[model samples]
Target: MYSKTILAAAAIAGVQAQSSINSTSGYLNYTTVTGYFLQDLASTNVSTFDYTATNFGLINRTYPATAGLKANLTQWQQFEAQVNALNADAPLNTAYKVLFLGRHGEGYHNAAQTFYGTPDWNCYTSLLNGNATASWFDADLTPNGIEQALIAHDFWAHEIATQKIPYPQSYYTSPLTRCLKTANLTFSGLDLPQYYPFVPSVRELLREGISLHTCDHRRSRTYIHDLFPTWNIESSLTENDELWNGVTAETSDAQDARSKIVLDSIFSEDDHTWISITSHSGEIASILRVLGHQSFSLSTGAVIPVLVKVTFLPSGPPPSNPPYTTSTHCAAPPVTSIASLAQGCVCSGTAVGGITTPIFNISSDYPTSAGYQATDLGPVVTSAPAISSYSY
Candidate 1:
């Protein structure tokens, strides 16, 4: 519900003259401009591309606008010039932006999912706060997750130093704990422009799909602010999460509806041409769907840069949003489950549970920093070994 324009980046030399579009007053259309980034190419497979190693997927090519700049600029510098030129020449109703969508580093829940297998995790373990090993409720980034974020931090530092890549003028993150921590670690200590710091706004709509899993339930807003004091908590983010009810899982249609709403809010209010969003795999997928982009799943800690063209339109009928559906899960670990998470598992006992109520409380004693230990919670039932790589 909270969105705002970032005027700070307009001070950048080349972008100051761009025409502005009134995205708030009318309906809007979003389209992804292909042929610019390698990630968008039909031939480039996402399964193998490591964005950190590939200059964040910027194609190695020259832009028409770059001829006026220095002769030996890096590919990213040339690309930045091209984006600025696009914005500068855009019509009154159209605006161009480069959205850097990044998925958070591995969380304990991701590790838990891998350890327990998809079926068991989806049916039983995912509902519990944590087993003996660690807590996945509003799951924190594991040590490996921290390492992945640090890799992103180093990648950003190198990009800014060598490629002259345009840093994000405005930042946004999901209200979930893993995303909050990932955004902090990924952009915190970089040599950013004075006007644009790593102060990301915590957005409620950017959270993961409502699956009624403990990991999908977020902590209180106050806890988020206390952990990262400098972050901008969205104005409408309630002190406690108001949307999750632990009984119903959001349908893809429902998720897409909210994703469009959040994207529309951002496009209307935030005028910055370069933006960054840190969120989960499912939510990011929903955003890509809303933006009319191809289905490219991101590995944990991976980043994708999208060039988006948004046009304001006359108001029309709103899109239909299907209601959330009740998720039936096993009360205890199932004897066997289908590989697919969408299907129900087979339980040994006759008892089955439907997610209808919240199970965990957001305690004030939640750790204030990332340095807290699993031992602080209790003894380990089973150790969740650090996973180097995995995706949703």
Candidate 2:
């Protein structure tokens, strides 16, 4: 009788031990899967005084240099705080996969040249210094552009080395030259292998006046099929269309297609552990919107990673979308109005400590030491991160 009891006790202990091991392994797996996006920050907020209803003037007028500066500064601070919080709240074994979205650094194009008014053929001229032979779509990154890519690359490298997130398995870019250059520089800086699968189909919808229905054509579907030969692009497209209205040439449609492509690629293959994509702000913003993020803007050289959790059970349907939610802690800061002055100067806080200082130091540095000392640092910098105009 005592032997029987002892045997039962041993069996119970073994089962408990096995369950504990499985639980630990599951936890470790959960921590390692993450996705990220980075973008060139553009100020979208416009002041009431400067409001103009015509020609998206509302969006263009609010440059990072002027009224929108303070908002951008606040957004970055909030985003960084969210990142820190996620690292803290997640399990110690969790790792991350980063997706970076950015605008090509400053180019030769005139800022005043509006996309709506400018001809597509002429678009390349200002951007490419009138060199017709040069490929406008794939132009080289400007000097400052390279610097921006390095900033993101260095930050990610530090995070991966110290935080234990896996290096990206693939790097994707638009067919455009500038985007390609940015991706190459980033991968080279990180010392990672390059895997380029041209996604011209992704860019098709972004072309001047393509319709959502046209974007969904079999030809477009075929292109996706070729890029990801094993995945069912058609089915994914169908699903996305159902969820986000039909796919059109509109920025919103392009975003839907891109997000679906990404999701399908990740789920289709088990071998690929991490992926990274380099694309524009409009597309990135759309993806973020679909993922339930309210309004988080991407800054130049900034990277936003979304950590999605998934589970495939033996007896249940796969969750419609991966269990992913962005960190709500990264909410944008409250808006503050600056009093307009007739002649005196207004200054926002300078970029310091990798985080924008809250207090805008509005002071004039004059020759006289006494005058310089007396100058007051104005309101904090609230400008939005510099975002590239999609029209370009």
Candidate 3:
């Protein structure tokens, strides 16, 4: 991945030498992640993201915010920093609560399509040969992804000192390598006097939309523990991935149910007023839906701050597949099947977007796969907007 971004000088003294070349970053630095889908010439038909609009800070809009509580690039970065600072200083009685939503940076899978082309390159042909899987399995951050995270770190560090926003007292991340890596990179270098060693919790529920794709099949738990020794993972997760099966994928309702579980666990805990959840684009959309907000799209490495009002009713049973509809994004076509796979199994209509769910049809509209759209729930849970900021 670094090879794609930073220009490397020839080896010096049997060691790698750093090149001084600029203009080497992979994927021209488009401010938003969704922008890639729009900007790719190959995907010209895909709708361009409304970068100029106020999109709840999910897309890469610039800060201070436009009207409508939209995020500029710095929304989460600034919020998280302020959260820690405020949490460390607030009086014992004051509990300032906020939820910070963030999406992971670009991974090998995102870059793969551009390099290999789609359909066969995206399906069994590329996956079975290990050509794509080798580079994208449980994809980690591309060089550009890391750079985005670095920008997040600097932005947060600068904002907490200067801006007035709630920073996160607790941090959570998806189990995927791309998301975990992004979380670590975004929060590692901050100079928070309150929480120096702010180790984030890894929740399996935070994983991306489940699918048969190799990129969706996470590494084993033991392997994950080894990879992220510092992260505090949920004890409940016992397998590499519990939901994804090559033959079938998780439905929007199922994913939303999972999102509810994530929230239930969080609200169950008494502490951590302002929390941060770092996950994939699909999972993030699920979260917004479960929280009763308009579905919003997010660019990788971007953040949104929502003033959420959650009502916890532990004794009551959870809603049964909340009444909802997903705007379909999958478009299917026949492709050569994997020796162990079926012809119509992958890339089927409305299922092509197995990992990310559906395309965010409108700039501010939620992506197709959101959870809990039912209106008859016992408690009233509402999600309103708040301000956002960042540094770099």
- Structural similarity to truth (TM-score) of each candidate: 0.85, 0.38, 0.59
Flag the better candidate by lDDT, 1 or 3. Answer: 1
Per-residue lDDT over 1-392 for candidate 3, one digit per residue giving the tens place of the 0 to 100 score: 11323322111110111111111211111011122112212333223343223233332333221234435425544434333343344332222346667788888776775665565554443232136244576777889888877777766665565443345667888888888888888888676547535678888778887654557657667766877887787787655344443334566776777676666555444244557888888988888777665556777777665644333221244344432222111223333323343322345543323322321111221112221111222342222111011000
Candidate 2 wrong stretches, greater than 4 Å: 1-104, 107-139, 160-164, 189-248, 310-392
Q: Lowest summed-lDDT stretch of 10 residues in model 2? A: 11-20
As for candidate 1, its clashing pairs are 132-381, 247-355, 247-356
Q: Which 10 successive residues of model 3 have the least lDDT summed? A: 383-392
lDDT of 2 by residue, 28-86 (tens): 11122222222112343312211112110111222222333344433223333334343
RMSD of each: 7.6, 22.7, 18.6
lDDT (Cα atoms) of all candidates against the true structure: 0.76, 0.32, 0.52
Give the lowest summed-lDDT range of ten residues in model 1.
383-392
Model 2 C-alpha RMSD vs. true structure (Å) is 22.7
Better of 2 and 3 by TM-score: 3
Best by TM-score: 1
